[model samples]
Target: MPIIRLMLVFLVFKSVLSGVYGNNSNSENDSKVLQMLIDCGGSVTSLRNELQDMKDKLERLRSEAATDTYIRWGRSSCPSGATTVYDGFAAGSYYTHSGAAANHICLSKKPKFNYHYSNPYKSSYIYGAEYQTYESIWNNLHNHDVPCAVCHIPRSSVIMIPGTDDCPENFKEEYRGYLMSGHHSHTAATEFVCVDGHPVTAPYSSKTDKDGTMFYFVRAKCGSLKCLPYEEGKQITCAVCSYSP
Candidate 1:
């Protein structure tokens, strides 16, 4: 217990003892009572320290739980030092649908369905994402269904940096790849994402033109956007980086 609380407890105990003893004082009895108080104080201090230690441990666990998570596109696994929350297929809206969502999603491999079927009418759909362009840097994973993994890293923040495959200083690179999104002239727009450098197809996947959400390699057109560090017709690279402070 705290020193102030311990002192209060000691004072209370002394008051109770004096009330009971009522001036029938003996030195031996007083010594025994003092020793008892010291023993009790030690026990209280030990218990308080243990409780404080447990509180510290719980705080650490909470910090770890509030982690950084991101989707590792074109890969079915997480990188080293990261935990795989789940491996799944990359899915998004059709590339030609003008009213569809602009961002992609990782569809869980093992999905749970509700007992009641809610929608019976026509609605928007999510289709499997595919790599539509071939690039030599990616080992030619063209026209293949993309696999994605949801990854988690404790006590960290992650970011995807475009234009260069290397991470910034003080940041650890999770994976590096080509930057991609829907084709420029497509009816539907899409947000750019970083595909894995060593891309892999989904399990039992084949090369087919099931034109869902497509990953077309991004290129730099550097007229207004910086031509010094970048050039036209050159494919842009991206790096997924994480920092733990």
Candidate 2:
């Protein structure tokens, strides 16, 4: 009976030891799980911050794109009742006499002096009474003149007294005034005479004469010349003017 009691006590001690080991193993496992969960939460937070940074960068780029500033003036057509007298194309915000930009003119299309002499001692001249396309005129000017009239024309005439008598001597009288063919018809369309040093929207003026003729004046600024609308694939250097009687 004593031997049986001792065996029972030994078995009870072994059982308690097994229970303690099992509890220790479970506690270690729970600690490992908690550590893994904390690590996963930290990684999630890092990913969210990275995503927010990327989003902020994308938003800044979008804002900058939205605020980008550049003005583009589409093709312009010549004034009514008149055809293109010149054509030109320039690049950049500014222009120069001898630089990246180009200036073009059509002097051949200008009015020609139709001499009329009542007597041998006296003479008269008739200028610009014919209707010609701006392209044809530009071709004529290009073929006839050297160095192109757009660049060679006097700057004083183009800038100081535009559409006035200060224009090139050959085309001065024809630059402005009434047509010999039609007493009521007149020519006051602004020409792209010279380039400005900077980029600017050309200044314009519109007026109606008592004769019901509408005049449009597109003045050049910022060292760049004014441009007019022309046929497809062609650039015309003339302003628009409309007249209705």
Candidate 3:
């Protein structure tokens, strides 16, 4: 099946800041908290720490609210003691074989605009992403406008959906949102270009976007090496292969 189920994989990242509270919304309580942090000169990191506590509480509530989601879609047991939690997170960011997305980053006025890798493998789930993904949301994490599709997948053992399987919790998308990243090898799945040259990405062991628009060469008829996702500034297209893993 096309990767429709998405897993709420737990991903961990470096603690630069705790979390950004949504203050502009109708929640007066949230507005007060944001003002308090700003007035107290709380560093973004420190504020996020405080906000994280709130998230933890919310997570508990969310977990309780959707207890069946964990049981149904979450991993109940690892197969033959496979090591989960790559780098303390069940999920994290990765470059896919034919995946395309804008990497959020921070920009200092540079004499020239160019793209260079910080070293793709060296990219971390939390800290490094601050430059490419989170921070890049709108230059220095200032703009809170980001829209993305949140796809959930079930546990590793449960690849295909059975007739009786339940769906995972539906998370409300935020202007600035949360993602389970830590997926280094997941995006590296063995995707291939068709003989007709259309990009064909394989299903991830964990999860993948069902909406095929994320892959650059998805519909393009480029067989084998003839298929290449056209890369643009601050955005890119690539393939993911899981064959080696």
Model 1 residue 195 CA deviation in Å: 0.7
Give per-model CA RMSD: 7.9, 24.6, 28.7
- Write the residue-wise lDDT of candidate 3 on 1-245 in tens digits: 11121111111111112234223334454455445544454465578799999999996775444311111111222222122221111121235433433232211112253468545664334211211123342233221111111122221221212111122333321111112122333353322211111211121222322221121212223355243452223232221111110
Pick by TM-score: which candidate is best? Answer: 1
- TM-score against native, each model: 0.72, 0.23, 0.15
| Per-residue lDDT value at 157 in model 3 | 20
Ranking by lDDT: 1, 2, 3
RMSD of 2: 24.6
35-110 per-residue lDDT for model 2 (tens digits): 5555666787799999999999997775444321111111122222223434222112111112212212232323
How many clashing residue pairs appear in each of the predictions shown? 0, 15, 42
lDDT of each: 0.86, 0.29, 0.26
lDDT of 2: 0.29
Residue 4 shift from truth in candidate 3, angstroms: 44
How big is the RMSD of model 1? 7.9
The candidate with the higher TM-score, 2 or 3, is 2
Residue 194 deviation, candidate 2, in Å? Answer: 29
Q: Sort by TM-score, best first.
A: 1, 2, 3
